[model samples]
Target: MPSTLEQLTSNRVKLTVEIPFDELKPSLDKAYKDIAAQVNVPGFRKGKVPAPVIDQRFGRGAVLQEAINDALPSAYSSAVNANEIVPLGQPEIEVTKLEDNHKDVLVEFTAEVDVRPDFELPDLAAIEAEVPVIGVPDEDVDERIETLRQRFATNTEVDRPAQDGDVVVIDLEGSRDGEPLEDATAQAITYKLGSGGMLKGLDEAVTGLSAGDSKTFSSELLGGAHAGETADIKVTVTKVSEQELPEVDDEFAQLVSEFDTVDEMRADIRKALESMARLDQAADARDKVLEAVIGKIDIELPQALVDSELEARRNQVSSQLAQAGLTVEQYLKESEEEAEDEDAFWTEIEKRSLDALKAQVVLDKMADEEKIGVEQSDLSELIVRKAQQDGTTPEQEAQHMMEHNHLAEWMEEIRRGKALAQMVAKATVKDAAGEVLQLDRIQPDGSITDAPAADEQAEAVEADASTDDVVEAPETVEAPAAVEEEAPAEESAEKKPAARKPAAKKAATKKPAAKKATTKKPAAKKPVADK
Candidate 1:
């Protein structure tokens, strides 16, 4: 085989491959077998149509086209392998030569496809990630302990108007222009003020209204069939009450925790908070290192990649929001885009997707260079962790996930996680004191450590992708709230549609499904092959 390469803009390449007629014989034979199996010609059995007779009836051009169609994928993959090409999506193939009558001649074709542009990896040692050495603030310790105290607190009825933090009993009715809405009314509903967990304008409606006082206000329904619909709401305050929190003492500490002393509980809270802070710090360090490494390298991304990524993300986000009981339209409106248009949302998705792609590509290259690999234990640990979170055993969860066609996705995610773990370990991480911090490696000692406790909040992308708060990692390992966790599921979540700590988080890259032509006698059609 002989081939020539042409560089096309947009990170695409054109490969013109030439093959001697003898080399095309295999595909020719296979195409004949396939056609014979499909079409019936007169007195012959289903698969007994001789090549010569078939050529005479269907024309050699048809046979040539069929053969080319059958040959394209293997040929392209081989050529790509031989040339060390890294394709991003798929390829578009065009057959330029048939040589139907001249069996001794050559067959030639050209494939124009998007490929990953090659870029050099920066030294991992040179990358620096600064993590603040966060200590448990004393006030936070008190706050955590106070939460426990509140749990054991008793509620007492009050005769005064409601205030923030006060629990109120109320009767609520909602109607749109005087038509009562079903499922939009509650009786004796106990709501805590300042929680903002109810409809818009709810806290204001009953705040100063004492028992038996009724007020009507216009507010938008938060959920149910009438969500996003404005409804006139009427409320009657039945009771106002406050939580009589247990006194912070030794007895209260014994009731809430294993420790018997309040002082001990406070100390325990500090340790727990400190551990959480370190995990948060770890997550931050991973993001910083990935970003720093990406910033050091410049990669020319394919437009096809961005388009595919964007389309996938659009679908993924839609899928996720639907699961959480929200519609795309409703989400977009609530997002309040700066441009006040859908374009702004999509533009931000594109940018984040591209950045994630670049980061993962760089990390993958480094993984290969450093010979970092994922181990079975590493995979098992991750599976077990995910299983525990989902309330199932690891084996059962892994088996179910595999049965549902997620094994490959799971494996790829594990590999990328290990790769990222390697990068984090090798990365130069420093604390607020400028002291170096070494994060546990991904199975460096054959025991995988716990990943950072990811924040479970789902950021409304259409509303918040452009916000400075949408961090770098994904939500879960895979979810629409982040990037498409497949398609290289750019760890660019949050790309995390993972935890957005490492767009590498959502590393379950999906291969876009290729389109298959449905020509009955494809041999007679044009020899062009597509992805």
Candidate 2:
């Protein structure tokens, strides 16, 4: 096998490869056997048809095409590896030459594809980023405490009209054009007057309505058969009640937490908020440092890759908005984004998508340069973090990871994260007060501490092993099958990029052979399982 690379562009390349007759013999043999099994012959048994006989039935050209298609992926992958190319998208493969004559049998092809361009990393030690000092406001603490108080609050029936903060039990009858809508009717529904998540104008309609008092209002149906249509809603109040929160004292502290005093609880809350602020600051610092690094590098991006990423992001956003039952206009109105119109919103999305791609490329290059490797411990930590984020058990998260064949994807993510952490550690970070920030000591649990010794780390993992079920993942996880870089000439020109193709695992990781977990999935909860 011989391959030659040509620099088509700074971010694109052309690879011309040649496969000898001997290298293609295996594919040719398999193609003949496959075709013979699919076709019936007059005398020869199925799968035993001679090569010349099959050629008489199906042209030698067809056999060669099948053989070439079968052999393309391995050959192209070999060429890519030989040239040390990091492909960014699917290659445009073309069979430039195919000689099947008895005298000279050879196959030659060319692949043109977008690739990652080489760029120098900035001097990370010289880069500096500043974040605001961690300060938990008194109001924030009070608000957190108020939430706990509300959780323990009790309700008592009141002989009075419904008002804000009052929980009212009511019966609803919805009608459109004087016809009753069965789908829109409910009885003995308890609603908080000022909650604001229910029907529009419901709080005003229920307010001042005493028990047994009835009022009618018009609101759009949100779901069911008549979704988006306005209907007349008749509300008959059956009961009104008000919440009585527990006093903010030692007794309340004892009831809500293990703490014995309100002061101790408040102090804990303050500490928790401070820890949360530190985490937020760390995240902000990471972003700022990454942005600074990106700003320092000058790299050309492939337009097609950018377009593909933007399209994917748009589809994802559309899906999320649809799930939330929100249109773009409604979402923008409710969101804190500065984009005021659809055009501006999509423009922002494109910019963010491009930035994300650049960041990916940067981190990938850094990982290569630094030789960052994903260890079993790294994967275990990732699974544990995922479980915490998804509110599921670590075993469940690991099962999901294996079931979905995300081992390689997660490993890459861990490598990139490690690379970023190294860069952030090398960079100078400071707080608003001009005090230097030491983020390298920040632990995965969000606490700032010294790195634990190897034995201590092992012991910690052992302690959590019962709950985490730390998988013994291989150092290298194979990626999902990619699109064949070699294709039939006709099909090669229009093949969708590998990123856009429907994924089918050629060698998916096997699910654990242990008993399946019997814990039922929580309602309205799902793991963020996609890579």
Candidate 3:
């Protein structure tokens, strides 16, 4: 087979291949064998029919058609390999030349793909980013504790008028132009006086009303029958009740949480709030770092990739609409959005998709330069953690993820995250307060606090410490180039030694692991069983 590559664009190429008769012989022989088993030949056993006899009976053209059908896939693959084209999706193949003389078959095809961009990544260390450091105020923790207390609080019947925070049980009806609407009537509906339930003005109408008191108010229906239209809503205060919170004492602490005393509970709350604050700051900083990197770099994305992503997004939106008991047309009409106004929706999705794609491209380039990677063990640990989160066994979750293509997609996300973390590690990040900071400090696991400052003494110490750790864990396991680029970022950020944390460590570390572990054994064992 002879093949030639035609350059269509920087990222796309068309391949033309001519298969000689010699190369097509095996497919022809196989096609004849299949045909011989299916057809009858006089004075011969079922499997003993000669190819010449079969061809003479069925016509050589019929045999050639079967041969071409059997040979197309192999020919196409060989052509792709010959030209070294990494195809993204299916290629549009067309038979450009065919002759009955059996001299040669000329086939031409074009593939539109998203090839890896060829560009040098900017120096990540030179990128300067500000990481936000938001302090969790004491009020925030107190407010959270109060909310928890309220959650456990009991409701007691009150003889007085309903007030904000009081729960009221009542019967209600709504009407448009004085005619009651079918969907707007309810009986024995329990509602909190201040909660925005039932309708826009129903809560306000019931507030400050004593038992048996009735009030009528007007509201624009937010959903269903009279949606976006004004209607009269009537509510009655049937039974008024108020929440009675337990006193904030040792008893309350023991009742609501594992803590023995209120002081202990308060300390836990403070710690939790501090942790949340740190996480928020880290997330904010990560975003700023990415924005800074992207802003400084000028990279051109393939138009084909953007178009493909847009098509995928459109399909996703259509699927979501179908799930909501509406077709795309019905959704547009009901929401008062024009079908032609797709530009408005697609414009937003496109911007987001572009940002996401740009981030991935930038991080991947950086990862390649930095040689980031993830260990198989790390990936396994991640998969196991995900399984636990989904409330299933690891084996079951792995099967589901594999079947749905979620596993591969998730691994890519993890790989990208790792690369970004590495970039963050090398980046010059400052706190919102303008203080220079180490990346580890802002990482979710608090190990960022151990990262060396830009000082010579700290750098020397950290270098020595890292060398010792590597020496101690001498089992060298190589990860994929893409995985390796990001693996270190995750490894360096996580202080734990084991990829899958020990049972004891699991209790201490509630933060979810980054990936799921897919055991090839479970999937492979089934094939063996079938055999």
Candidate 4:
């Protein structure tokens, strides 16, 4: 087999591979043997039929197709290796020539692939980032301490009317234009005042109401039928109460926290805040540093790869909505984005896909230059965390990941994180106040070296926006059936996407959230398991 590459663009290449007849013979022979076992010949036993008999049964085109299917992957792999190209994802392979019945003719094919473009890295030390200075205010500590006390607070019945930060147990019904909506009534649901995950105007409508008091107010329905439409909201408060917070004392501190005294608890809270602020600073620096790096380089994107990533992202959201029993139109309405027409929504997806692809190419190259890799310990930790989140054991999650081939995606997330961490370390960091910020909390790999134990890694994840779109382990560990049947991620430009299940999306129309993570999902060519 011999292959040559043509540079279609800085980041795109067309590889033409010529497979000699000798190399094609194996797939051809295997195709005949497989077909022989499936067909019954009058004079021969199953699997014993000759090639000539099978060829006569099915035309050469049929056999040629089967052979080409078997040979394309290997040929594409060989061509990629021979050309020393690091592909962004799978290539679009096209069989341009088939030597079907010609015994001496070569089987030729062309594969167009997106490759990692070469770019120069600037000196990291020269890069500067501005972060807010770390300073824990006295009021912040007091509020946190009060919050801790509230956690151990008891529910005390209050005779007064409900107010902000109060709990109201109520029954409610919703109707639009005097027509009752189905699945639009609830009984004895406990709602926290100001915790408006339910609907708009809930806090204000519920406030100032006493037990046994009923009132009707107007609020937009959040979900179910009549989701986005304004409706007459009837709410009756069955109970009104306030949290009886424990006193700020030594005994209270001992019960609520590891600290023995209120002073100790407050000090720990202050320390934790300062530490987190520092982590945030380092995180900000990493983003700025990366953006600086990408700005210095030029990249001509491979349109095929960009299209794949775009489709992958769009399918990802569509799959989620389907699972939740929704349609794109309903989803758009529910997300408050009905105004964002289909063309505009798709165009936005394309833009994000392109940005993500561009960022990945840069990060991957930086990782290679710095020789960054995911360590066994880090991977194990990630596996353990993922397993816990998935409500399974580490061994089980690891085994599942292996079965479905997700380890590489996880490893790539870890590797790129490390590379960005290194970049952050070399940058000059200053607080918004112009003080030289000390990023002692950040490691070269962008992890918090001394972060507090609770939700430490989560903070790190929040800080490093670059890995925001990495497929999480639990998502990959979903039921095997879901995995196999999942819509294929962005397909190559050559393939058409599969039709989604024709389920009606009944979700109420709403606006899409601002800045939903359109993060780079430019990894393994699998249907993206979105978080």
Q: What does the lDDT come to for candidate 1?
A: 0.62
Question: What lDDT score goes with residue 471 in model 4?
Answer: 14
Sliding window of 10 residues with minimal summed lDDT for model 1: 482-491
RMSD of 2: 15.1
Q: Tens-digit lDDT track for model 4 on 1-531?
A: 799999988877898988888887888788888888898889999999887777676766666667666776777777777898777756666666654444654677787767877678788788887766667789877776655554566677799999987767888877777887654577777766765566667778889999998888887655443445577878889998785667889997777667788788777767666655555556666666667776777886666665655566666655655554444554465553423666765565555455555666777777888987767987887777778657999999899889987777667767776666667667777888888744545533333565544434333533343364321100110111100111111112211111111223222211111111112221222211111
lDDT of each residue in 1-531, candidate 3, tens digit only: 787877777656676767667777787788878888898899878877897787678876676666665666677677666775544444555555545444443323333334444556677779887766657567876776665665666788899988887877887777877788865666776776664534667667887899999999887654443455677878887888787766889997777677899888787776666655555455555666777877777766667666765566556555554444443333344353323454554454455556656666666566556666756764675567667657888888778778987655556555566666666667787877898865464433332355444432122112212111111111111111100011110111111111111111100001111111221211100101000
* lDDT tens digits by residue: candidate 2, 1-531: 799999989989999999899899999889889999999999989889998898887777777777777888888888888998888767877887766664446888888888888789999999999989988789877877766766666778899888898877888888999999876788777777776656777789999999999999998766544556689999899988887777999998887766899888888777777766676677777778888999999988787877766666677666655654556665554445567888887676666656667877887788788988878997897788779757999999999998998776677667667767777778899999999987755544445667654433322212222211112111111221111011111111111111111222211121121111111211211211111
Reference-based lDDT, residue 309, model 1: 66
Clashes of 3: 19
User: Candidate 2, 471: how far from true, in Å?
Assistant: 30
Question: Between the candidate structures 1 and 2, which one is better when assessed by lDDT?
Answer: 2
Q: Which residue runs does candidate 4 get wrong by more than 4 Å?
A: 52-64, 96-105, 158-167, 182-184, 191-210, 220-229, 307-353, 370-378, 387-405, 430-466, 469-531
The models' CA-based lDDT, in order, is 0.62, 0.69, 0.57, 0.63
Candidate 1 residue spans exceeding 4 A from truth? 19-23, 38-64, 101-106, 155-171, 180-189, 193-214, 218-231, 236-243, 310-350, 371-410, 441-525, 528-531
Clashes of each: 35, 0, 19, 15
Model 2 alpha-carbon drift over 4 Å, by segment: 36-46, 171-189, 193-204, 217-234, 319-325, 391-407, 451-531
For candidate 4, what is the lDDT?
Answer: 0.63
lDDT ranking from best candidate downward: 2, 4, 1, 3
TM-score of each: 0.70, 0.76, 0.67, 0.70
Candidate 3: where is the Cα deviation over 4 Å? 1-3, 17-88, 96-114, 178-189, 195-198, 208-214, 224-226, 236-238, 296-299, 318-346, 361-396, 405-408, 435-531
Q: What is the C-alpha RMSD of each candidate to the true structure, in Å?
A: 9.6, 15.1, 13.5, 12.1
Q: Candidate 1 clash total?
A: 35
